[model samples]
Target: MSGQGWERRHAAEYGTTAWSRAVVSCGALVAHHAGYDRRPGAVSEAAAGFRQEWMPVAELLALAACRAGQAQDRPVDDVELPVLLGWADGAHTHLLHTGPLDGHLGPAHWLRLAEDETCRSRARDVVTTESTLAIVESRELTGGRTSTPARALRLGARAAAAQARGVGFPAWADDCAWAADQVERLHLAMQAGAWRPTSAHRAYAREVHRTLVAEPDHPPCPAGAVGPSWIQRVVRIPHVRATVLALAAQPAYAVAAPASDPLGAAVDAVVHVGMEPVSVLAAGLERAWAAQLPDRPVAEWELAHIPGPVREQIRAVEALALRLTVVLLDLWHPHE
Candidate 1:
């Protein structure tokens, strides 16, 4: 298909009333590092599918671009979906939310790309996959605590957002420190055999344990009673909230791994917008508990070792964060 035709079709696909909201809402949620808003029947079906199905990161960025390039009458004809200007727009919003600007890049820079036809037309001529890739690859990984690609991307997004906002870039060191402290405390508790779940945690763990034993092959149903958001509600006690926030912020836990099917690889790296951090942590906890104390009663699960998955999960989160940063900023400042 011709470029314009392809963009038109892609734009139309996500331009429907329901999908547009899904795109925008998901972008906002991911930008803020918030998880699924899991009130009963709170999220629309379309949004649920978009998040739960793990759509490609590229397509999510594309849909956001389609929204930014959309006009009152129709979507922008020259808007290159692959260019991903829409996500940049969202990032710009995220930057604004972080703090006030001191007139660095200013609103004019974004306004030109968003409103000026010439600027939008210019994007098609200048933006290409290789060109965008070069920009992403050129960014130095700085200020991230982790050494993975996702950490690089997270830092990259922060840097780019800072540059775009024309403000002093803030460090994520505090974020890293806070996450580490929380994890370490949990580790120490586990080591001493003093880390015990409260009544709420145990109750939830029992339910999760039951679910896993009953259907070892069943996938999690995000809309069900034990859905992703259910963990958030159950684990809201004072001690667990920080750990949940730290884990959830990683974003990789929100990314579903590819299935064994041939086509699953395409969507494997897709980030689930509806995924709750606590849900991922709880899932890991549930699996570990189930594996260690399969026949033992729930009362005996406290003796189980600290989950091996925590280290891996933390690593994965950093890696995915970097990948997303690159994707989101690939075609950044296209008009420039």
Candidate 2:
């Protein structure tokens, strides 16, 4: 591969331990053929993820093995191959387009695996050459990012729970948009005057029911658009703050929201909007985009989203997604 090509390929392969294992497997096979098992640091070095500098050597050795008939190189169509391919395609789609906040936990799991020297050494033994000493010992298989498996698992579980709640950005944005609409409707209901008397309360309840019937039950705005683009539109809406504050503010909320639970469904809906992960993502993107503007100074997370190298871009997107969740959650429910 050309220097640029190798760089791009490495960028794609780096930080994903599965690919590292594949490369190491190639290295191991080459070691078996060349008697590198007898060498002192062979196994440990290969296990450490085979340095970038060693990649060309590994590739050349692998090719030579295949040419010499020592390593059989052929494509086999397994029954499960199609199913696996479909899943991989779907996962990529979900990650980049449909559900960016979900299922990028592979790196974390790999990092854990990298730490287990015993298991790795045992696996190497299982695939060892005739003489038995292995030629692959490597560390930091999943790049330099320090992701705890337990923490990654928690985040993955949360993201999965959020998935059960709804699909990507559109689904979440629709809820918020609908909630804002509810707030507007409630504001309109209270606009005439305060309903102090029992009869006035009844009349107010009737009005709420009528409005509820007139408006669609489901979210109206989101038409399946995903990610920051759709949410940017939502953040740009002029009346969002005013509408949210209509229900969130003290006196207005107290007087406007009905006493009975059914009559106060609008308030409930707004609260539900706050609970969804997608809403949090939207809020985070709002803040990030704001920082991107010339007047607003860019923060570290904000700068990550800027166009750059493939590896940098991938890291940036992941960081932004993670940071967004944190920031939005804090803003949604800031604690003392």
Model number with the top TM-score: 2
Q: TM-scores of the models, in the given order?
A: 0.24, 0.25
Measured with C-alpha atoms, the lDDT of residue 188 in candidate 1 is: 50
lDDT of 2 at 192: 44
Return the TM-score for candidate 1, rounded to 2 decimals: 0.24
State the local distance difference test value for candidate 1.
Answer: 0.31
Local accuracy of candidate 1 as per-residue lDDT tens digits, 176-275: 3343343344335434657443443333333322321231222232232343222222222112333333433444433311243111121122223211
| Tens-digit per-residue lDDT, 307-331, candidate 2 | 1121222232233323323332332
Runs with alpha carbons beyond 4 Å of true place in candidate 2: 1-112, 115-229, 236-242, 246-253, 258-261, 274-278, 291-336
